[model samples]
Target: MKRMVSASAAAVSMLLAGTTHAAVVPDYQLNSSWYSNAQNAISARSTSLSADSKAKNIIVFVGDGMGISTQTAARILQGQSQANNQGGEENYLSFEHFPHSGLAKTYNTNQQTPDSAGTMTAMMSGAKTKAGVIGVSDNVNRGDCDVSSERLVSALELAASQHKATGIISTARITHATPAATYAHVSERNWEASVPEECVGKVSDIAYQLIHQAADIDVIMGGGRRNFLPEEVTDPEGSTGRRSDGNNLIEDWQNFHRTGQYVWDSEGFNAIDTSSTSKVLGLFNSSHMEYEADRDDADEPSLSAMTEKAIDILLNDTHQQQQQGFFLMVESGRIDHAHHGGNAARALQDTIEYSNAVQAAIDKLDAAGELDDTLIIVTADHSHVFTMAGYPKRGNPILGLVVGVGSEQPSLAGDNKPYTTLGYANGPGAAASFDAGVRTDLSALDTKQLDFQQQALIPSGSETHAGEDVAVFARGPQAYLIQGAIEQNVIFHAINQAADLGGNAYVAEE
Candidate 1:
């Protein structure tokens, strides 16, 4: 969605006159970590709590379900894949060298182990909400229809309100919880295309909200084209639309922006010249995009390509309009899906690609000499239950069997069975017969295969999220605020302070 050229006068009014409405987030939530940690971040840097905003642009990279263990394993995989044949432990992901890093407590207001909707809401809106909701306060119940009063403004909304360019990129459905949190305020995350009959007109679906409410967004690229098209229509990929309301939100998106371009494949994506394109909507798949290892480059653009193009388009907007810099959120969304399937190979591969996307942004900004003026934050919304266990050699293949140092043979447990270095606490990969006290033998199985499910301790239909702290790394203006252990919601405050969005930075009383 893009702000209309005809509304330029109103846009300027809103930017100079302040927001037309106040965010409905509770005062208690606002005064919580969002205020304290922001003050603490400035204090730690020996700067004024209400210091002048420094960052002209902000880019947030989210590696969905990329935990500490996943990061370590992926680092090794990336290093070992290099031509130098070096030991993998010494290598670091691109964002690891970001200068400032911290741990975030990833818990929802209702659940100990968080869901993406809540975690992303906390990061984008500066408030921790209930697990299944997006861009709303904790007061609303899951699936509730009466949520207009519970709306919480996100960092993207703040940037849009200030007449700044904004964009969202995800490997998952654009309507998925994490990306949806940037703009949609739904009481239930499942309301992607149409809500239940009772909530039909009262609550607009997430895709509809993206087209109507958050229409000011400058860039939108991801899967879930089915959610936007009429059920009678079939996409170029031969997938039928899923919307039951007969409303084609994709058409509405194009109609909303005079210069908007909607693309469905790599050809159309590559054809766009960012210098002249004011807005773009790219939906490459009907559902979630393919994992990096399984993706066809001709059908879908790589995450790094999307990142580069998004930066270029947003950068062009700022220069063309003489507006403040842009705000972009990019997510490697399929990392979580691969982990859920108990496929560590695809998970680690997606994580590596996520790192490449981060590097792409760094390189793009560095080339344009805007790296220092941009605030880049790379973090995960929450972690998976994935784990890396056993004592393996430094040069061991991260996806191979666990072989002890100086031992070529795989390590065997008391039951005399071999296991891989990577596994899950619970998933489809559980031992063949746990009740019979039998563990599957991995001696003949190739654990490095993309379809190979790692051995798990408990049998579960799907892996669950873990209730542990996730890491946050940052660089450039106000990056110092990311240090130390802080509540997850503090992320929004740091961004707000960096860009002075909403003009709501807390000022210490002298």
Candidate 2:
């Protein structure tokens, strides 16, 4: 069921953007109905709007490459799916209803349109860094280990230090940029399994850091199974592991957490008892996990399933009473990958799935009556160059061609060719790739297919990141800090404050 909450709902009036004086309604019309409502909304949140004394739990959802347009498109696509729907603009994703939201400047120190490694580092470590660095200061070079001595501690590390349970979940490889930022510190995001020979002894690989440097990951679930196993170890899929190192990190991780269970498939994942089990490590794929649209091959758990399991395990059944709170990061990592591949359908599908995962977490929190104490922050690491253009009529299918208001045919371009409503500014879909002089008419094509790639302007093998600010949506305790146009590092501050990790808690550790 759609849990509809009025944007003007009390306690959330101006919490998201933290703007109370009316961003839309201008001019001082004190006698107008709009003015009266605005006043009431501001008055509504005046009672208790301070940061939480201490948050019992914290969950951050990063929909990689989910820009403003991606979010808007997904919201409409999801809305249009329902039998009872208006123009679709009225439709809201589960997390969109979050009382607190703000814009985050996603650029890194070195690049305008940031990479996941740097952007996620800002959010997870409370420090802005260069484009390709992970969990380290911006002073280090991309591949140089000589300056890798200084590492910025992450919120998860701090949470772990405070004796709180910590976990990371993703649709991509667990050792990928987003999740790795929560734990690993390395010069390059690509150094997953095989560290370069020159830096082998000096710099540890990401997968190596996951088992060694990371805080006690109570509920680690994602792909990147090959990165942990040795080269001789054959994965369940018959693919050999990538580690040149003789060590099998999987068994080592299991041994590190004596009671922890290592799982590599759906059967093992689903059968585990999160209540009695304090730790879980599951890698479902050899590398990146399958997209939601293409998961028929195996009995893989959906993002929602993984989210629920992580939440359950972190909560520790309350009876165990071993951990006070938890910090979890859930990433829809393939949204960015699909965009880079120029597949709009896959990206939007993954965004919807990310929304579903957020909803699942919300449901779990509500069921446990922890909504008041658990802070939920949903944002993105960066954005893609994908765009939604060619204005179509209201309620038009988001993935369909741009149809004129009264005409049955789609709008024609300068070359007399029809275009799709969704497309990339520059990507593999660009017409230049086929022929510089010809434009393919998309009218007859199955643009709505799951594998469909939106047409682009330039011919690039992969789409590039867009240099624009992404959105941050928050709910629960201390979410008010999420308001206003802010830098990406502010996210770490908000979460750190909410969880009472102490101001700049990790600085002392460094």
Choose the strongest candidate by lDDT. Answer: 1
Alpha-carbon local distance difference test for all models: 0.84, 0.80
RMSD of candidate 2 to the true fold?
11.5
Best by TM-score: 1
Q: Count the backbone clashes (under 3 Å) in each candidate.
A: 0, 2
Evaluated at residue 443, the lDDT of candidate 1 is 92
Decoy 1 TM-score against native: 0.92
Expressed as tens digits, the lDDT of each residue in 161-189 for candidate 2 is 66678889998999999999998878899
Cα lDDT of candidate 1 equals: 0.84
Off by over 4 Å in 2: 1-51, 318-320, 431-434, 505-510
